[model samples]
Target: MAIEAQAPPPSATGPAVWLRKHFFATWYDTVFSLVFAVLIYLALKAFIGWAFVDAIWRVENKDLCTHDAGACWAVIESRGRLILFGLYPYEEQWRSTLACLAVIITIALSCLPSFWSIRRLPILWIAGFATFVLLMRGGFAGLELVTSEQWGGLSLTIFIFSAVFVIGMPLAVLFALARRSSLPVIAKSFGFFIDIVRSLPLLALLFAAAVVVPLLVPDWLQGNKLMRVVIAFAIFFAAYQAEIIRAGLQSISQGQEEAVAALGMPYWSLVIDILLPQAFRNTLPSTINQAVITFKETSIVTIIGFFEVMASGNAAIGSGEWGNQYVEVYVFLALIYFVFVFGLSRYGAWLETRMRLGHA
Candidate 1:
């Protein structure tokens, strides 16, 4: 006698299946999930009510804000300019705004894959930086020249970030190569140099450059406070980045280099054409990580009297009128930081994907 064939198990689909699998897979899971769902809903509702429903938005109505329960967003509306531009001259603030946009556009253009080549990248960066400096400094085209001391707010932050990255990246590559030198003396010396710099706190380094170096160096050598700080920051960034790059170099198989050498390629060609490319591709993520850290560290310059974004925020709240709105200013500052950092991370991920696909 033939037995009836068994049917395959039925498939679950859509929201009901998802709920059963995740929330009701076990009794404890079901209970916890329901409890969490209620808590999340209540929290979200409360936040929405405070942040939007009861929030005041008019600058003129800022006095209406009480110490009761609602968020005082009107403070932000009234004082947003001061938060963004700080002690930047009100009439010249438009120049700062345009300069900031120029820097942002430059950063965006640099991140695109199309400008990745050596010829294009240098030209793009130089032109971009020139425009940024020209617009901000304003010595050309009949515009008044603004000194570094006069620079403040988001413009200062952007300037520091760009200058540090541009200078630090090449220095990092050089340091990494030197650290990996075949000669023991050179490698050891480079390693010690990197270690010494890396061991020092960024604040100490910035302090030394901003204050100590001036007393020791010649008159002309002692540049603007901003330049000194940027140089110090670049040194600090390079030290950390060099180690990351050397680690990437170490990750590559010796056989690949050996094979290239056996093919009669010159040492410089082997390094430039094969080794450096592979090492950089391998270390792109780490490089981006270092960059993000450096970008955040720019806020430290405010301690040395440079009015970066953090300083601007402080100025925004320090004013007696909006003294209680420090939290709002900080939240806005955080959003700006998030935008830059998030964009950098996304670009890094894109570069990694491209490298993996052999596009780099």
Candidate 2:
């Protein structure tokens, strides 16, 4: 008996057909879908009501915040500068703003495929980082000299994340390569070092970098707390990222390496043109996930006396006057984090789609 192939099922082109086909496909599905829809509706309604309808926005209305049932956005109006700029000299905050903008623009440009080359990326980041440091530290071109100790808020957070990624990514590739070295001594040593670094918590590493390193290292080698912390963070980032790269490398078949080696290709060309590109491509999802996590982890620097956005938000609401408005301050901070994280997530999604479609 020959079976005839039936025509493909009709598309859910109409609203009624789509709803019935998806939401009410089964009794259980219908129940779950309706429940979730109602829950979402209620949540949105409550949030909108509290966030906008009854919220206080006037700085002078701070006194009425506690008495009201809704959000007190007045705290933001009053301490917005502190939240965004931290302890940066109020007069020189424009420099911090510009520095932050530079880093952001640099990051945005780097994400574009046009600047993906090794040479272009290094030059772009160097220019961006230099602009950031010069603007923030500014003893040059008649700009006021501001020490890093006073750097805080969003600018500090951006600088730390950008520096760590730029430094750690190359180190991650090196560590991964060393771990896979043909020499037992080199491979074992690199593996052991990575294990040791990964075994410890990031907080302890950062604490030691900020506090303990100063007491032990000579003054010349000590550098500033900020630099120490950044270095520690970069090292920590590399140790974890290396394993991800190694996994990417492992995904490559032996034949690919053998075929390239058969042609007596240079080692550098093998890696640059063959191994690393495929490794990174294979590991793109994980790499992007790691980057997103690293960005969020910048908040942890607050524990070691640095004031990133989270700490700055705390400072915004810590004063006795606006103390009751912690909720609003935290919400604002969450929104800031959401914007960056969401952007990273969307970019990662776009990259995945592009690569999957062979357009990348």
The top-ranked prediction according to TM-score is 2
Question: RMSDs, each prediction?
Answer: 2.7, 1.7
Q: Model 2: residues >4 Å from true position, as ranges? A: 2-12
In Å, residue 79's CA in model 2 sits off its true spot by 1.0
- Compared with the true structure, model 1 gives a TM-score of 0.93
1-360 per-residue lDDT for model 2 (tens digits): 999999998665888888888899899999999999999999999899889998888977766777556898888889999999998999999999999999999999999999999799999999999999999999988999999989999999989999999999999999999999989999999999999999999999999999999899899999899999999999999999999999999999989889989999988898889889889989998999999999999999999988888899998888888888888889999999999989999999998888878734
Best model per lDDT = 2
Which pairs clash in the backbone of model 2? none
lDDT of 2 at 176: 98
Which 10-residue span in candidate 2 carries the lowest summed lDDT? 60-69
lDDT of each: 0.86, 0.93
- For candidate 1, the lDDT comes to 0.86
Error of 2 at 296 (Å): 0.8
